[model samples]
Target: MPQGPLFLARAVYRRRRLRDAARLLPVFGLLLLLLPAFGEQSGNLAHTAIYLFAVWALLILAACLLAPALSRSEAEGDPETDQGPQDMGDS
Candidate 1:
């Protein structure tokens, strides 16, 4: 493989991953935000169903947030990329 396109490709991959992690990190915290609410158990089937739905909804939302993050890692090669400080200046 030629060097030029590879470097550009890598830089693009890095930026995409940065963008993706930027997006997901908040919603990931939000799913954690729901954890306390998930534990208030009552024996009603309707309530159980609602809880189930809510948990799944959060799971889906978190997954939606994560989809890009995961894909970025996949494209960028190796999910072991550096998670450096959040660049507040760029935000």
Candidate 2:
């Protein structure tokens, strides 16, 4: 009984991820920022969040600029579908 619901939950989450990766980026970023700021003084987690947002922003911008080339290469070879670690970048 527990295994069945767990599998269903995982599958549902995976489906949502595939539908909207952008929606998740900010959420994970926020969790990364908020979760660690619980104890102590000064919030190092905020700084970490800023760094993450910066990296994510840069990657999205770069990906947009190279969309044509990326799509072409993907259509041609479908890297992740057929290749190794390099293909992880493909949409």
Candidate 3:
């Protein structure tokens, strides 16, 4: 049976490198939120907010589209390991 894209994404997020990359989403979001502060139009709070919001939304959309691909690349470069929780019952 063929696995769906969601299944592949779930598998990718299970990897350490991929998971680490995934954790950056919030950092990026915060940075994007602060972007208007660095702009020359800081005086125009409304325009700055709208511009920042649009850019941030686009960035988030791009990240969502790219995350799976990034994770897949990391998975390919690194060796696969057991992704499930450790079994403590043994030994």
Top lDDT model: 3
Spell out the clash pairs found in candidate 2.
none
Residue-level error in angstroms, candidate 2, position 55: 0.7
Q: Can you write out model 1's per-residue Cα lDDT over 1-91, one digit (the tens) per residue?
A: 2233334566556666666776766676677656656766556768766766886787778668777766766676643245555555753
In candidate 2, stretches whose alpha carbon ends up further than 4 angstroms from where it belongs are 1-43, 71-91
Using alpha carbons, what is the TM-score of model 3? 0.44
Q: List candidate 3 segments past 4 Å from native.
A: 1-17, 37-42, 70-80, 83-91
Clashes of each: 0, 0, 0
Better of 1 and 2 by lDDT: 1
The regions of model 1 sitting more than 4 angstroms off are: 1-42, 79-91
Better of 1 and 2 by TM-score: 1
- The lDDT for every candidate, in the order shown, is 0.64, 0.55, 0.67
RMSD of 1: 10.0
TM-score of each: 0.40, 0.30, 0.44
Q: In model 2, what lDDT does residue 16 have?
A: 41
Q: What C-alpha lDDT does candidate 3 achieve relative to the native structure?
A: 0.67
Candidate 3 local lDDT, 14-73, one digit each (tens): 565456656777787778788767767537778876878797888778688768877677
Which ranking of candidates, highest TM-score first? Answer: 3, 1, 2
